[model samples]
Target: MPFSLSIIAEAWPTFEAGLITTAIFCSVASVLGLVLAVPIALAQFSRSWPWRVSAKVLVEIVRDTPFLVQVFVIYFVFPATGIPMSSTVAGILALTIHGAVYFSESIRGAILSVPKGQVDAARAAGMSYPLTMRRIVFPQMMGYVLPPIGNQIVGLIKDSAVLSIISVPELSMAFQNVLGTTFAAPEAFVAVAVLYWLLTSAVTLVMSRLEQLTPTHRSTQEMTSLLAKADR
Candidate 1:
């Protein structure tokens, strides 16, 4: 079989459109997911049993089910409830919710990872609970949370492919269309895979740079303090 650069060249416009759609979906979902996640994470870490239980149950339900099922439920079943949404909207909603559940867990874990003594110190300093969390805990937790959040963002990009099942015209759908038109499955898929690889690598590179720019860990701080004291 002859190599066909024309197949890719012809599909470029469709692929570019699909890439834009996928990026938009992922960007919206990531922001919405973070908005949903913070409150859920707070609920999960709350003192009230009911709040924690409800949050946990919601997280468990979302995490246990496959994302494709969630998309189908949102797109198909939601219409019966008198709330009609387009496939793209439903797909975005599903992806956002799914990502929120996982991201909430990451946030909760990061918050809890802060030493209890830090919370106690804030309390002893006469800081209100909310103030203490805002001033002390949150800043520290962000450093811990960022890496996992970056991973989830990458996962969300890949998971956006599932939206094509509902006709969202994402990258995977564009690849399928190319295959249908040109009968070039391998080349089309190869191009799609390379695009995805580039997307993920870019995310990883950005994340690594952010991590390096962030402050050093507690141990590093402690070691630095000790060195300063010795020098003094």
Candidate 2:
């Protein structure tokens, strides 16, 4: 029942490399997810039934399936289609697509929560779809979406551990190697757990700060007033 941090010290280089990989993987994949998600979320509200249905199906399929399966399919099965990818590329694709769907749903929910009258007002005033979204919907929706989006970002960081399943050499895989050579599972696992906690904590901290920096909902009211004036 003996425990020692010396095991971690012994393989510090491997652990450090893994930590760096995890950081880059998480940040890049999360940003890619968010960027792709916004458009897909908007598509869910599309006037065309086909676009709306297709977007909804994509979102649901990704959300419903387990991430482990998604990664396995991307890494192992996908190459059968004749396009081979490195483990890293496959892992990144899985993370991006999976996270994007979740982010899209968060966005779609926030968009739906906006008052119907605001949307109508924008339409009646001859505002284009994109402009209405910008001037009317987004202003109010930002507050509602921020909290969930923050949660999703945290999920993205933690889920990067799954990248190890595909042998992408992430933090978890690095520690698994440590466990193999040292037989010190306790210390290796503890180190990775602490590192993940630190990364996620930083995400929550930054998100909270951003939420505070967000202006009050005065913009929504201003948008309403502008719509009212235009109607006259």
How do the predictions measure up, each by TM-score? 0.91, 0.89
lDDT of 1 by residue, 165-189 (tens): 9999989999999989998987898
lDDT of each: 0.88, 0.86
Model 2: per-residue Cα lDDT over 58-105, one tens digit each: 887888888999888887787888889898898889889988998888
What are the per-model C-alpha RMSD values against the true structure? 3.0, 5.2
Candidate 1 TM-score, C-alpha based: 0.91
Q: Any runs in candidate 1 off by more than 4 Å, and if so which?
A: 217-232
